[model samples]
Target: MRLEKKVIIVTGSCTGIGKAIAKRCVAEGGRVVIHGLEPELGQEVVQELGPANAVLHIEDLATEGVAERLVAVAVKAFGRLDAVVNNAALVLSSNLHTTDLTFFRRMLDVNTLAPFALIKAALPQLKQNRGCVLNIGSVNGWSGEPDLMAYSVSKGALMTLTRNLGDTLHREDGVRVNQINPGWVITENEARRKHEQGLAEDWYKDVPPVFAPSGRILWPAEIAAAAVYWLADESGPISGQIVDLEQYPFIGRNPPKN
Candidate 1:
């Protein structure tokens, strides 16, 4: 029960890694407020966690006032906020030429700006409770794939945001912030995206070892485990870290074999 009695807000929690984090948080004795764009999916997670442990908030981060509203809902439901996981993001594919101004803005708004708004909205409460923040960044934050230009830029901004706030807030208000940049993860959304992109249903199972060094890509639960450690008191006041959760070192890689 690392998070016993803690109250947390997890955006994009209707599915995928966010869903796993919400479930894990509750299982460890914390209450959660789940957020997503899909009402049906959000309700499902709320029901899964039960009324006693979870609530739902349907939000589009592109909309104004939603960030403040999300924080309010969490505090209203649980009486206090102990942590927030900024896990919602737009993971669309776009190369340099394909990334128009509108597309780039949308990516930044969802992946980077939304987290900034959320942390700002939750700051006062976090200060009061000495709470923490967890940003779900991506390995793309580094150099990134050529196909993921705008998305990569957004994540890079988010990484910088994590470091900037982590340093400032912890020094001033005792609020800790950290980020996790996970490699390829197999989620329901990812599988569906693969199917939509003409891949077979078992595409995940057949991933090449070069991409999945452990013979498989990561699962949502694995990321959740590390998230819990950062959110819990056991992490002991450390802040401003961007942890890359990958099996292989991403730097100076050789091109794939023919």
Candidate 2:
């Protein structure tokens, strides 16, 4: 087990990529603190991973002081914290014309500020364990699409936060921080979102190559696999890095031809 005895907190873990990460962590012999907005899903995940290896905490991270509560749960359950995967995020799409301060603040509060609070709350335990933090960022952080103005801006800030804290904590506290910017992951939430947007249930099947290069979108488990490497001791003190998980070059890409 690559992560034998390690204790990790995976926020937004009740579903999507976060869910996959919690499962992967336990499968690799780690204990985990599962968190999300859905209590039932959180409980189900804890049950699936077994109570001994996992515990659930349902939190709206945007709430002030909740980050500390999450850390406390981890410590209370397993007595230590080895890593934290800041994977919980709110992804709302809005173009410049539709974007407003309310939406912008909501996006930043959940996507950016919450992660910062969690890291700060867990810093002491992390320092003691020589632990690490893995941030689930998005390729959209690179200026995002016109339809995702606020979301893109939030992710860009998150990327900056990851780099800033990764460097600061590594130097001052021995806690490694890293990020993964994933592109077009297929998940229950993503599917629901598409359906809400009037796409067919199998809309992904007909997506253009520009959207899904492999004739399919990325899977949550793939991100989970990469996350383990960064969270585990095997990464060996590396920090301040971002991994872009996508099929194409993020820069200077030629538009797809018909």
Least well predicted 10-residue stretch by lDDT in candidate 1: 249-258
Candidate 1 — which pairs collide? none
Strongest candidate by lDDT: 1
lDDT of each: 0.93, 0.92
* Reference-based TM-score of each model: 0.97, 0.98
For residues 133-250, write the lDDT of model 1, one tens digit per residue. Answer: 9999999899789888998899999999999999999999999999999989999998998899999999999888789868899999999998999999999989999999988877
Off by over 4 Å in 1: 254-258
Give, for candidate 2, the lowest lDDT window spanning 10 residues.
Answer: 204-213
Report the lDDT tens digits of candidate 2 across residue range 1-258.
Answer: 999999999999999999999999999999999999899988999999999999998879999789999999999999999899999989888998898889899999999999999999999999999999999999999988889889989989999999999899999999999999998899899999999999999998888888777888889999999998998888997999999998887768898898
